[model samples]
Target: MSTDPTRLSRLPIVQAPMAGAGGPALAAAVTGAGGLGFLAAGYRSADALAADIAELRALIGAAPFGVNVFMPHHTATPAEQERLRRYARSLARAATRYGGTVGTPAPGAERDDWDAKLALLLAHPVPVVGFTFGLPDAAAIAALKAAGTLTVATVTSPAEARLAADLGVDALCVQGAEAGGHQGTFDNPDDPAPYGLLTLLALIAPETDLPLIAAGGIMTGRQIEAVRIAGASAAQLGTAFLRCPESVASAAHKAALADPAFEHSVLTRAFSGRWARGLRNGFVARHEAEVPGVYPYVHHLVSPIRKAAAERGEPDGLALWAGQGWRLARAEPAADVITRLVDEMAAARKAHA
Candidate 1:
């Protein structure tokens, strides 16, 4: 089989694996539209992930699709844990307003069910598997390759790209700083590289022979063409699909993306302990300065409050993750979004040619 990642789909577009926003319906819709779609396995139990995979397969049949998993990393230190606890305490007043209570800091035990999910993928053998937050070890990579899975590693820097290349990954999803949700900086989640998607692609392309998939702040067909010209084989977009009808994003989240009042996206560790870009809201404004770098701990601490906010349909309290070009995202069907992107990309390329 050809190792070319682009060959997996008829279109050069790839729907990003956004944990909460993306699901089987959205994935199937994109794949059915001739683009490669991805089902995010982050924040899901092994059983839930298996169900989603089965559902996606049932819906799309043999259409090419992918799964993205969060590679586990231990980022919380003792000092960070103490700071997280203090931050949790500070949020008591806000939590009380939503009838929610912050939880105690527990970092080490959270694996996001990595082992079981990997075992499931190995046994079932998906078309493509991508990792974010960090790269899996060589043994895991070899095992997945042995199972006929095309493995992709998300990288933000040339150094990280080199490490992934050494492990022989099939491709690199070069995520830039402007990407929505979490920045996939494996070494230091607190401090991500300041480079843009095009710049990161420039830096990483010469370092490895792996196919590159550009992600972050890419919403228009022109932007996709620009990335392809810069050396990416494909473009991966998350926020552009958040408002699609097939997306599983919360109503508050979808509304926030279109609300002119939300104004701008700010990269903050307020919602999840790790750095993520989201539309600025009251919660972000109040807590961005005080939040610690203890991921999953702070993530758990803020869960109930976010849940309550979501239930109440209050955009101010929920994490409204979006890319910089969020203003360009439209409310439409997932298939329409894919078709428009593909059409636009062709037009853009033709105009340049």
Candidate 2:
């Protein structure tokens, strides 16, 4: 597959797509600066996503932008869902501490309004597209390509990268072991691919010729150039962008991101069923073991309590997602940060020379 014509060349950087962090302004800023930015649509509904797209258009002209969708899974059975409900109830004391009540999973499951969202994207096609959790079926991917959307799928291993290449994706996002949020593992959430980006690139280079985008604990420009030399076309960052002024991160989330107290993060299914890395705070420490492999179930189990905690500034109950190199992050203008990252990469290459 050929590279997408609409992709950025001025800057070989992708503003890490962040969910719930004012996506429109961040994406528009990055795109405006000649790099790509993406909005995380994981927890958003179709109507909300449509509104976000409108906001993005208002902020940035018909410039290139990307929206990432989390492929939804079938919800667990009633009993299983109920079990999650009981699990939420078990956290009552913690909820009360934040002046919140635990919530039950809504009565039914929604596909994150997949068909409608797809229809919306097809109607208002963005310049770039990516999917996580899982790739949409071939028919869906084909539809996006037909509408002129450049497709990229995130993968954790060389085997998965080869699968995306064979399936005809234009590029692959090689997310290494240290990435925050979900791991994009095609297999089990618990069974994360342990390979770091350097090792992953070495393993994948021989398998597929697809252009790669490297992601993980890529803090400094040195790490970015290392990935570039290791065979990636660009680098994507999440934790680094969490503190940007344009981000929609809550005060609590931002505070946690800057907090020296929360020194480490772990992969936990306690917040969401999928394995995600985040600051090792009160919540993960208390319940990671109790969370079941059942996703929306575990996700449902913790939704209410998380919200309650957030509403009251209780960081302990909120999901403070951050990568390993989060401490290296600095608060700055999104565009400046992007420009700096490009310069840093260049500097790293120069120093080596």
Candidate 3:
């Protein structure tokens, strides 16, 4: 079976899997609208992920969808760990303000439950499975293949794309620098290359035969058509779907997307300790410089603070993840968003022709 991303959906649109923002209902809505919806398995236990898969299946029936899991690769040395500890100490004042304590992460506590999630997928396979943050091993890829699952690896550069291709992934989601939320930079999480989606696609298309799904700041039909012209099989969008009614984005988050006071998005590791693009907020402005380039460690350290901020309805403290095209995001149904995108894409293609 071919793992062509274009063939998975009637429209060449994919709703990018956002950890907390995306849910089964959002995925079902996109799938029902002839685009591929995705269930994000990030930040969820295996049991929770399994339950979501079942719910999505019930909602969308046999409509093809995908599941995205964060590929686990924690390379935090003792030095990095100490740096994370120092970073935690620096946030003590802020933690006090939030009425929370930054707990010291135990050694190897940053694991994202990769093993259990993989086991769950093997037992009950989905149509498409995507791995982000890092690439899985060949055996893992083969296991998903044996279960009739189309495997996708998210890549940020031509080098990453080639590495994923060598691992025999069915497809590649070529994410760019402008992408919101956490970047999928597997090797060097600290410094990511600043390449736009079209530029990265052009750089990667010549290196691999795998079907390429372009993801980044893509939002409108014109942007989708632009990527298609640059050799992308499809475009994956996250922020555009964020305002959809089915999205699990907090009410504060939804409002922030529309709030002009928020201004622009910036790539900051203050929230997760990895380079992720999001709306610049007070937390980012205050701590981006102090953030250590450690992942799940910093993620765990700040978890309580973020949770407290969310509870207090303070957008400034929460990670307002959004791409550059967030200004164009509209509050509508996911299906309507897809329909409008398809129509806009058609118009753009026709205009270009």
TM-score of model 3 vs. true structure = 0.96
The global C-alpha lDDT for each of the candidates, from Candidate 1 onward, is: 0.87, 0.78, 0.88
lDDT minimum window of 10 residues, candidate 3: 102-111
Q: How many backbone clashes can be found in candidate 2?
A: 2
Error of 1 at 345 (Å): 1.4
Writing each residue's lDDT as its tens digit, candidate 3 over 205-312 gives 887778889999999999998888888899999999999999998888989999999998999999878888999999998999889887777878887887777777
Off by over 4 Å in 1: 75-77, 104-109
Per-residue error at 185 for model 2, in Å? 1.6
lDDT of 2 by residue, 34-86 (tens): 77778877777788888988898888877777888877677677776676766
Per-residue alpha-carbon lDDT of model 1 for 22-128, expressed as tens digits? 99999999898888999999888889999999999999998879999987767577787689779988889778877777765353445778999999999999999
Better TM-score candidate (1, 2): 1
* Model 2 spans with C-alpha error above 4 angstroms: 107-110, 191-193
Give the C-alpha miss distance for residue 19 in model 1, angstroms: 0.8
